[model samples]
Target chain A: MARVNATPRRRGAARTDELLEVTLELAVEVGYAGLSIEAVARRAGVGKHTIYRRWPSKAALLLDALSRVWTADLNYRGTGDVRADLREQFLRSAPALATTPIGPVYRAVIAEAQSDEALRATLHEMFLANVEQSTLDRITRAQQAGELVPDVDLTFAAEVLCGALYYRGLLSTRPIDEAAVDSLLDMFMAAYGA
Target chain B: MARVNATPRRRGAARTDELLEVTLELAVEVGYAGLSIEAVARRAGVGKHTIYRRWPSKAALLLDALSRVWTADLNYRGTGDVRADLREQFLRSAPALATTPIGPVYRAVIAEAQSDEALRATLHEMFLANVEQSTLDRITRAQQAGELVPDVDLTFAAEVLCGALYYRGLLSTRPIDEAAVDSLLDMFMAAYGA
Candidate 1:
């Protein structure tokens, strides 16, 4: 995947990146309902035809924008330690949820997906696949190293780990502090440890 | 607090409940922005004065209606075990998130609360308080029973436990299943267990 801030010197690539950036900005400002290709073009100083040439629909554009922005820091080094990996993975995710525009955009997209079937499918394919994969990979490594119970449900465990953080960031008014992160890691280890 | 569907024998109470019911129905249909006392009266076969005599504004009426309908399940029991209590509590909550109209109302209210402080305050005071209180009570009891570590941060732990479910239900299109609930409980146990 291309670096998020990589400037596109090529004309076509620059235009595409500009369109995605405008789309994301509009999504934050006015929400998914208020976003449009025309608005994005106006914001980006591009034409509607340029946007249409690259993307099929507003949902398609939105999905591409989301995918471009959502780079997970999946750099977990398995030192034969499952608990450490889980903690590291969660630590990476916590900052993303707190510091990025992706958090609010993520909330808007999920709200949009509730009503838009095509968008829902697209989001699931683009976002959910990678998240589930990263989680499953970590759990599988842990299980293989005998750090976790052999019969532990990997998919369910992953969701619970990520799901707890998701709950805090999007749903609760409180911030996800270091203590909360450590507690989550502690909880995971207690439940899944061999 | 009154029973959610308590019969109102008094004329005033009956009329109040009737108006609140109309408000809830309209909120569900048209969302918070489109809901108004005039529209609610029209829908309920009542007058504007009838609404004003009770709630001072649309926000107040919506808050009252939400309070009445958005009660959480207080079905958790510690049994001197934090893990078992969490599993049972979430199992009960999972169904409510998946099958209840309260789920949509919660989503709509949360989205609206992003911009409206009065509504947000009322929601926190009336609706969220119940949830927070119930969860905190369970955690506190577990701490006293030595099921949880003495130094376990009750407030943060509560957020981790509840925030995850709230995040998944409000943000994700996917259902909150039993397996997810179990995994969360396991994580909680791992973190806070004595």
Candidate 2:
């Protein structure tokens, strides 16, 4: 009886995952300039109202799709050592550079945000806030554990981590590989670690 | 006779400077979206032909105008110490944040660069090359002076410095102040200085 009930649940989950995957593939193919709710609905084989029921606008749908596609490994705790934890986190997340269309999508969004106030606010609230909060949480925990220097400014440190990653992503065409991540971790630790 | 010739030379230089200033002002008001060579010529009180004689196209004119306007003081010589040199260089350049529309203009150019491949290559060659070159020069000098660590990757260090500044400028409306510059220098030194 339990196995029978699990069949429907698994099917539902698979359907949702398929929808998200289709949305991401469309975003990459058309760029953000060509993204529309109706287009996403058509591409995903889902109804316009169905997509609208889950996401209010194209921006909301894009954000939702991004969240589903670009899942970072938040479990970066490694032997309670901050440096190792950061290196591991960066390495795991770094592969998204090749697998996802996140870099180009982010650039397109930022470009539009320059002229569109609503998109700007949405980007700040959805993307920037998520990155900032997660980084701060990790750094603050490290500080409390005496792994980071007592006097290190947690906010600035958080900015440095995200800023470096963002800088590499936007400016360069190269993938953010393990070597770059390792060097960044080493630099950050040398600068702020206790 | 000498006095008359000197007066004419001084006036010509002053007029050229005024034209450049007006060009930047017009760019900010209209953006790259609506900017035209004729408009710039009218705004600067110069003949359209004269503008074209100097620059073949509107893009060329804007590039020349930007070159005259966006001047960073790259006189950072090694003080026989990498940390101090980095600190001084950042401190000196920090105040230009308020005095110039570099951030907005740069964002505009970068956005335009995405679609216009020719303009993109020209922008990289005319503007970005100088920035990268100056940064690498500083790092190279520091390396030669034995101020930087033997294994320090100058390319990565240069990226970290300029990349952080570009990141903040493009992503946020926040002013990059002296304190922020100081913190950045501190971190850079901690990471790369011997």
Candidate 3:
């Protein structure tokens, strides 16, 4: 599927990736409140116009950077066992999300999204596309397979489970360890498991 | 319980309340990023030193202002029916938290808390003290009264329910309506109701 101009496209993608890597690092260190395009440009060794050409606002850049960093490995193919699938999915991401280095970046983007409409939309769209909708799809599949209760509101169930992770990530001082994930799964399954 | 010098103490409290009123108003208008003690003081017609004398940082002031504004009506006395109590509690507040004027302020404080440790501490402490711990106590009482299952993790349950509110408030564009609150209650009760 290589284009005739694949080299240029690949180079552009690589450059974009490098800029996002720096964005993630700076977002962790200074947070969204302190993040700026000029600062990112200086750090990433790119001109301000280069950054501005791609993203209209700092929020837009952070939105893209956040999606790049957070949703990089979020490929969800549901296992037959709903509990196992959910546990595996959450265990893979939630702990890393609670830990520092990248955790603050996730937190910062989420925090900044509150005030910025475009960032909020991007964050919501990214979360729905990458996380929520995928979860609902799995739940639906599980319901059809008789692994989950068919009567459960899939959206509510998904929100409840994912909301706990978001809560722990953004608010709690304690790290989201396996035990916590286990409890969350237990609560989730006890309600919706067939 | 009025003292002879209650007038001066009341005056101090009134002054703080006025300052926080302006803080909440500006927070709604300009958000946490644009909010400053100087601006708040200017709006409230107070000296900068007067604002600084009481609050060391904007985050502190916002923390206080947020608590003052948001936690004003969080009356969570258990009425023996755990489900009904929780539903009423959430239905009353979630809509308000989702609506504008105050919703953005709540969102702003939460957003600022991610990068600011002191604000995070204040937010966490305030949440635990005013919201989570109280919810846990109600859940415990429900367990004792045979309204809720004995073995559910109260903390996890509280977090899940409150987390949904937080998620919807800060992230979703849709309001956390009565039906949503009812569904949330049904989900919570399904897992924990005896």
Candidate 4:
């Protein structure tokens, strides 16, 4: 999304996708700490300015790549059962973050964000905030439909839902499977289910 | 705890404590990525071998230091009201992770653990597993006292509880305040409170 405007109209999106793919590959190979704009350029066969023209920094570039990896698979089904919708979405989308390239690179980016405030802000705005908001949106509709208990604040619930998944999926060494998701959703439903 | 036996006589314990304190100071000052044995040794007024003799790696040293910072707090009190105890313990214990010299340093170590399996195991064994298990212990007593639903798996609940706190407290840029803690417990009680 960052550099989408600069590339030529046709094949531009494809080229951006390819560049991002390469970025992820390189991130996996050398790690986020070792990844550089110069290295990305060299590997992608593009000029350094070309990479820099779109992304302001290495974090920015990798963030975009992470966004691409995450964007496609995260849509919730809203199957009318908020719990089921959440469970479905969780099973579908959460595993990618656990997989290689994304997990390690994402962790490194998160690590770097600890020291770099600007990167932290961007990471939240571009990634985590989106996930959190999408979750809120799903549960909000369910609450309005009376699938959830009336008038209780669900924002923290959303955070806990997504946060638990993210923590288990990406941050920790544990694997989140169907049984785990079922237990989580069961507790969630016991709390919020109407 | 690692190098305690290596030191001799009455001052041995004090020297170990001072070294761990210096390690933490260095972690905060240089950032974990830039922290080194030489840096810690030079800052602590000790030889490099002396620092290395106790901990095999920088991660090992920092992990031990983290153990010290975390050791003094984190006990969960059984007030006969599980929710109150949880809320009280959360308020007392969770803030330290959100504070400087702990939050940032802990995040860096967690990030490093993402790539390093040994570090991940050590972190879980020493730090996170303890937190998770302690939460479980607190909740298990409540369940046995008939304060929670019978025959339900509380392990995932414990994970979600601590994981959400850790996520919001350490990982995310968001602040976990009293209101947030109340909201979290509200949902938890709704789910599990009997």
lDDT of 4 by residue, B52-155 (tens): 89888888888888878777455788888999888888878777665786778887887767667778877876777778888999999999999987787799
Task: Report the poorest 10 consecutive residues by lDDT, candidate 3 chain B.
Answer: B69-78
What is the Cα-based lDDT of residue A157 in candidate 4? 93
lDDT of 2 by residue, A65-173 (tens): 7766655654466568777777777777665533445656756777776666577667666666676677788888898999888877777667767777766655554
Write the residue-wise lDDT of candidate 1 on B155-177 in tens digits.
75676667667756654566677
Expressed as tens digits, the lDDT of each residue in A1-194 for candidate 1 is 35544544465577777788889888888877788899998888878898898888887898788777756555566767777676777776676545646665666676556445567677666676567678779888888878788876667667666767766555455556676778777666667778
* Model 2 alpha-carbon miss at residue A129, Å: 3.4
Q: Per-residue lDDT of A1-194 in model 4, one digit per residue for the tens?
A: 74785566557677678889999899999888899999989888989998888989888889889888788555778778888788888888766666664777887887677667788877887778788888889998999999999888888898999878876764466778888789889988999999
| lDDT, candidate 1, at B62 | 82
Clash count of each predicted structure? 7, 0, 0, 0
Q: Please state how well chain A of candidate 1 matches the true chain A, as a TM-score.
A: 0.73
- Find the candidate with the highest TM-score and give its number: 4
- Model 2 residue runs over 4 Å out of place are A1-19, A42-56, A73-103, A132-151, A172-183, B1-22, B36-61, B72-103, B114-125, B128-155, B172-183, B192-194
Q: What lDDT does each candidate get?
A: 0.71, 0.70, 0.77, 0.82
Q: In candidate 2 chain B, where is summed lDDT lowest over 10 consecutive residues?
A: B94-103
True contacts kept of each: 0.40, 0.26, 0.58, 0.63
User: Best to worst by TM-score, what's the order?
Assistant: 4, 3, 1, 2
Candidate number with the higher lDDT (2 or 3): 3
Position A154, candidate 3: lDDT: 79
Candidate 3: tens digits of C-alpha lDDT, residues B74-180 = 66756778888888788777755557877777777787788676677777775544677767777888998998888656777777778787777667766788877
Q: Comparing only chain A of model 3 with the true chain A, what is the TM-score? A: 0.80
